[model samples]
Target chain A: MTDRTPDDLYDALRDRLADYGQEPPAPLWAKIRAQLPPPVAAPQLRRRRRRPIVLLGLLLTVLSAAGWQLWLVSRSGPAVMPAPQTVALGSNAPTNAAVASPASAGPSASPKLGKAALENPGMSGASISETKSSPSTATTDNLRLATQVRPDSAASRRSGPYRPQPAGSVAGPFAGGSQARNPRLAVLSRSARVRYSAGQPSLAVGSTDSSVELPTAAAFSTSGSEQGRLPVDVVVAPSAGGHKAVERSTAPVFGPVAASATDYAPGAPASLLASRPVAVLSPALPQPRVQLRTDTFSTAPAVVRRWTVQVLAGPTLTHQHLGAEPASDPSLPTGIITYLDSIVNEFSRRERMSTGYSAQVQVRRVLTGRWSLSTGLGYQEYASQTTYVASTSTSTPPILSSGVFDMAPPSPHRSTYRFLTVPIRFGYALGQSGGRLRYGLLAGIDAALYLGGNSAGKEAVPTAWSISGSPYRPLSASVSLGLDFRYRLASHLEVLAQPTATYFLNSLPRPLSGLTPHHLFGAGALLGLSYEFR
Target chain B: MPPPIAPVDEALLAACRRGESAAQYQLYQRLAYRLLGVCLRYCPNRAEAEDALQNTFVKIFTRLDQYRGQGPFEAWARRIAVTTALHAVEQHRLRHPTPGTDPDDLAADLPSAEPSALESLAAEDLLALLNTLPPGYRTVLNLYAVEGYSHQEIAELLGIAEGTSKSQLARARRLLESRLATQHYQQLP
Candidate 1:
């Protein structure tokens, strides 16, 4: 044999071993198959099933809220009438303002101007001219109250300004109860508009600081009275009995004057009971009227776009796979890779779901009526426990030699992974937009970039095994689905609860050699506060 | 020499990604022979080499998703086999260290083998000579000489100093020379 240089030897080894081949043992296949985990269900296939269920649930929530709003609209009815009360009119002089006596007539009546020889110009049923009777001098300057009360007729229920009846068609106010005996006298003035609600007369007027209820026979029919500085005479004729003196007292009644108990005779007509409290005023009030118009009470619906910023934090449940290296002895029943696994049952232990947490700041903008787009940045952390059985022997032995184990091994317990997340989400609000409480469905893509990580355990000795290097991809993305529930706590602040589910679009790289790669599935609920810009 | 291993089919890899059992088996069948050759170069014996082969396949099937299609699938699989075999060698050394022949303290004074002796040896003879060396020497030799790895890369892979990798490779060559000399003399007798 001739001598060879070190370079020649290396070259020879390289050239000769380049085409090396060996027959694998027959049992190798069986061993490998036994060791492999069950076939993984394709993420896409599972994802397809998951997406529809969430969409269906979101649709149902939206539909249910819409249906409820419709039901409420359909069940609406007219304005409710108020209870009856007696009212008294006060004046400085003894005037000949006679009350209209309607036995079967409703509250509405035609206002006829009487050729009054008295100071007051005109009088009508349920019409109180505050300008003439008001005790205050300031109110006398700009205030004018010429009102006409109408009965509940088809024409009266029609919503509009009051219209005057034809002149000389009926008896005037000076005609007393003679002309108003016919219940068809539904007359009103043309300058102001008023509607009676809940017994308090709703008065609309221009530049008027105060309003008083109409003085009606129905108001005086209830038997109650109060002391007053001014004296006034009120006479009510019962529809059944002949004209009985309702109040013929000379007593000074400055406040409300009610009918005496004798006026409520057993045979008295209850025609006023069918009457809703009526207070009508002329529509021709001054320009820029502060008076309430019942026809203008219904407002048009408006669309509002909102922008919000939110901060969210919550606990998370993470599902991942931390597979172990193949066991040195493949014949071992459990197929554990080492004593570390032998002690921990790492196969099942690593498969257990772990708990984690995350916090994020988000900005959401309403794109239009019910759709919104959201983007946010966040930090997330997940911790998994791994047991490492380290050898405590200090003697560094030669190659292919066993170590001297003088003491028991220490097991390191936990490995933690942290990520920073950027997410872009599209949202569809589930319920009515104008309500204090609302729900929405969100679908998004969340990109998670791996941050730093560390392992924690009792390190009694420098073991051969340790957690080092980047086992996970630097960047990964996930499909995120969430249900967002929010309640408005103030004009610009809201409380939020968002339950989320995330499926990683790709798998996490293995942390240890011979371990399987795994995808991460996470579910969490985030409670947060949102501030909206008006 | 055995027929060159065929390049892995893309459809087979896609099917494997979908977790098809038949595709996994087919992939295993295609790569097993070549990977076993890699394992044998690092391992001390056939049983241990087969163990490494089993580990290599398990890793391949489980982590096949990591393959980004940047290179040939066969090359990726071969890299896995090499790493697995190296890990096996490390584990064996830790469990059963040779007392006097520390890999770091290997003899540098041994005579180099004759070039004519190496030229006369077949690939099988070369592999047999490689098996006689210590695990550390075998590892360094396989990585540096046969696998075309640099000293720095071998050092990183084996968790040793770069200088140590060079010394180990030098010692492994001298040991191979000594073994070939003994075999040639025994044949002369």
Candidate 2:
């Protein structure tokens, strides 16, 4: 056979050099030994030991905070104000007059007047009696009522704006025994344990309220002395037993009212005043002209209006599917085509889904009851491991020289993709707002910026390496749905667990040889804490 | 023909697996010369080959648990040496300007040595001839001929087209044959 044949020449060359060997420098082993990694079990053991302690610590902290918040809510009293007592209407009484029953004019007035009387308005006489035994009164209580005084009284005759004084000093002619026989008029004096002061055409009466204090509801101001005053009128209700009334017109109870013949009527049948069991009436004054303004404050439950901040982190499982066909470059040799097909097959075979992690901090705004909107910055990492196996057996169209050659063993290569994400989500809460346990649903879109990533294995195969630049759109987006579970640890703090599923809207394509792109899907349950501001 | 390979000592491998420093050192001493020879075939210089040898041994020790005693340990170790050497060559080519474009420029990067006289030479030093070739041609030749890789395997290993690997190997063989003929003719007297 001619030795000029390529195979013959190569075989001769391989046979001669097959037993080749050479000594390396003495320092080589020490260099390799220096790069050795520490044992793997230690770090894993430490991580395992740390988990339960952290969970227990978190539980203890939540319990302590919940107890503290409950204590605080109880000590702070009710967060809402009570309703005002409704003034019973009398037939002959002026519409603008604010009159009280003589039975309540005593110093033993019930602090539970507003609630009990309003609850049983038809049997208010019995309700007031039942409520009078209640000692649960507001620590700081004061009720103010505005009334008009008659111009003929010395209190109203003063020029300019009349300076107010103690209720006793301005009692006028109704100060002494006249106050006792007609307790309705006495309700405005010092004997009733009330503070009353009068200005031109206006009186300010302050009394201890056993229940609610409505200062703004009972205040009035007159601009000048030109504003005329109407005579103060008293309408007393009959007792529960139909007790005879002490006639106010029997004496000069009110100077202006007693002097007017038309206004004063002694022994007038109380029946003409009202059809109810008890009625207190005031003679209708011409142009009594009192501007009565009842400023009502809302009693609705207070809403949590603070901005909530949530920090979340979790382990994420990512699934990636890459689809590609070999490059159809027919101009290349048949061997190259075969090689490209092998590469695609190898890549598909080696790729595997793996777990990664994601973390984020979010600020949420409660737009209305049970509805919220949140946006935050987050980071997500996805990893895929590809294993490349080496072969030792000789292939067809074998080596020019017949000999065994070394090949690298099978190795696992991990390719990671990192993204800086911005998520905007809307949430709807389920169940009561202040309850300790609550559930919610969330839906949103997350936009991501492709942060650079690195591969953890052999770089020999370009298709197995981390992908970037072309084919990988620098920007990507995904739609996610989540079930959010929240446990309120305190008034302002809560623990949150959200199980989420996200599907990427865009694809990250493999470089070279790979034509079709791959989409990523992720599922994770994130645990976090949310704190609301006071 | 297959190269000569020593048998693996199971007891020594077990000790190395247990992270014994003495056993690791003994394993390194036993295998260093052969793996270094394997490294020299692909790397451009002895120093780079030595560096490749160091990396090869590091990989072998760290991944020793993965070795399942299928073939002789030497064959497995030699394979690691070849991969490490190829990685070094690839890194060197990337750092420099495109040396593959001009074969003469690529050959100039290697050290020049005199050919041994015929008859006096016990065996033809195929390695010296390989050193005279350019990096691309020499790598293709080493993988396809000496390493027994198919054109498709060579393409995947070197990240090149199979046609390119085939053509490069042909050129490398022609150069080697002509040089060998010249050496024989000069030593004919």
Candidate 3:
């Protein structure tokens, strides 16, 4: 019988098959691609050679500049001297001049004046008058002594003829004849025999030395005594049992006498005693004003302090499906699927030593729930051990032989590894749920900075050695999916668990002697603590 | 006459490759009713036919890469569809025991109808007749008359002897002939 083709049957079946056509789901492609093995590339020797040259140039330039700047700064010692102090005292002397000269001669050489007297000509009853005398010849010893004793009183103002008396005199208006017999003010005037009705003063300085009877509630009284040349004692008695006394002294005054009396309560009137005999003073009298001026200048400048710290450590498991490939070997006929699993145990040990604690300040803007946008600089050190395996087996040895090369099998190889990755992530927080127990999803890109690693100790004899082609290269681009969980401990502190799945897009440098390049699929789960402030 | 190639049909093919949901729905709308007719020739009932059609599409997309550029895309797709339908039939057989009926008696009751008359019949009428056949008979008949597989090829595919395949085809034809003859008589009365 002649061979008859089944053309018609095939055509009929073809006609019927047109009835069913549809597409698969979207996740199918993603899952399938994830299962395939990554492509291998030999590390380019030219690029490798150029990278070190560029890095060396950069290092040299930075070192040179830093060294020069450090040298220059060291050569120039402390930049500025301490400033002088500003002492607020009772004298009318200018701050700079009073700080330069001893206080005894300085304040009294100048005309007695109040704040309004300096600002207006006739307001405070004092005027400026210049004298053409030599600095050494201008003697104001008595006036300076009077100024140091009681600078705020009307009695001190009367010690200088150029000074103006207060509008109300000590014994002028409130001293009535019959009200000057009060027993309370009688102690103020020894020679004046006087009596007050109930609230009046017993003696008045302006009255005659005759016995006077007045109300006991007499509100005004005055008494005076002479020491050497001018009136040394001037006392005013108030019906409230309070009195003011002025005393004159002649000595080189270093500071205000009011400051010398530590028991001079504020807003209280007390008896004032002045040394009367004028005498030459020592040149080395301690100037409390000058000491105060220097103290104010010695203080340090105001500054803000901030401290940020993070620590991370945890165990993690990650599974990455490379992709499906056509069966290259008869032993695995269906196809080869690359699956990567990593069991990582890591510890992030950190210790921060600081003294003299300061407040932590944060200038972060809240972007979403429990998440904030922050622009800051930080330093982190990360290290991890990664175990890697390739799905394909080759009988040929690798072209370059590093220490790791002798360990790979002729069929396929598996190794436990270690490396450091410093990843800086910039992305948005997709969402977060639960308050104390929070979970958030983030998609971002990370830069994996490789340190180095040691290959697994277990070695398999090479069955197939290849010298022409390189195995898969290490991945470089880090497209990551991050899941974060945080438990807030305090207002500014939290403990967090962050699991990240990173897919590297670029290949890594091949270790010279291994079957596979350093390419890897890495995932990490980190349990860390963070401190924040507002 | 050749059917007009609508722009939407091309668009649907492109989108289906990209796994678009809208294109998949459009493809289902255009092909579901027709595929149900094809599925019924191998299925014992309407429910089983619809199930087979659903399974056929799922397999077609999954194995789309197996369809090399050697032949028409439609023809390749049809082979998958038919194979999927036959697999459904085999699965059904494992679940249910065969009925005790004489093949000759069942064949004697088959309907006799002209090819033109069968062609003019509505899809629904053809589907109804196909659903009435037993699972074994319906599967063989669809593979022979509708799908156009030779008895040898059918035997190889179904894992049965060539003689069994020929006998099954003859029995299926006689039953359809008697069913058609009865319909003609009913019309005459």
- What is the DockQ for all candidates, taken in turn? 0.33, 0.16, 0.02
Who is ahead in DockQ, 2 or 3? 2
Across all candidates, the chain A TM-score values are 0.36, 0.42, 0.28
Per-chain TM-score, chain A, candidate 3: 0.28
Candidate order (DockQ) = 1, 2, 3
Higher-scoring candidate on DockQ, 1 or 3? 1
TM of each candidate vs. truth: 0.48, 0.39, 0.29
TM-score of chain B of each: 0.88, 0.81, 0.79
Error of 2 at A234 (Å): 16
lDDT of candidate 3 over A1-534, digit per residue (tens): 022244442233334443422233344334333322232223554566457456545644564465445433333232221221111111122110111122223433434311111222211211111111122333454333322333233323323331211222221111111011222221221122222222322221111211222221111111121101111111122111112221110111112221222112222222211211111121232211111111111111110111224455655342222222211312111210000011010000011111110011213223323343222222222222222222121111111111111122223222222323334333344444446666666454433443323222101111221221212232234565778666888866878677766665543433322222223354567677767543
What residue runs in model 1 are displaced by over 4 Å at the alpha carbon? A1-6, A40-44, A47-534, B1-3, B94-111, B185-189
Best by TM-score: 1
Ten contiguous residues with the weakest lDDT in model 1 chain A: A169-178
Highest DockQ against the true fold, candidate: 1
List where candidate 3 sits over 4 angstroms from the true fold: A1-534, B1-14, B109-122
Across B1-189, the per-residue lDDT of candidate 2 in tens digits comes to 223355878899877765678888888878887778777888888988888788778667755754557687877787777767876776565566462366544333333223232223444256776687787788887766666667877765655666888788877766665666665666668
Q: Rank the candidates by TM-score, best first.
A: 1, 2, 3
Sort the predicted structures by lDDT, highest score first. Answer: 1, 2, 3
lDDT for each residue of candidate 1 in A11-122, tens digit (9 for 90 to 100): 8777778658777878789888887765667886477546645654564456445544543343232332121211222121112222222221112221121111111212
Per-residue lDDT over B1-189 for candidate 1, one digit per residue giving the tens place of the 0 to 100 score:
344667787799888866688999989878888889999888888888898889888768765755656578877787778867766776776667667756434444544457567777877787888887887788888887877777755654555677888888777777788777767766674
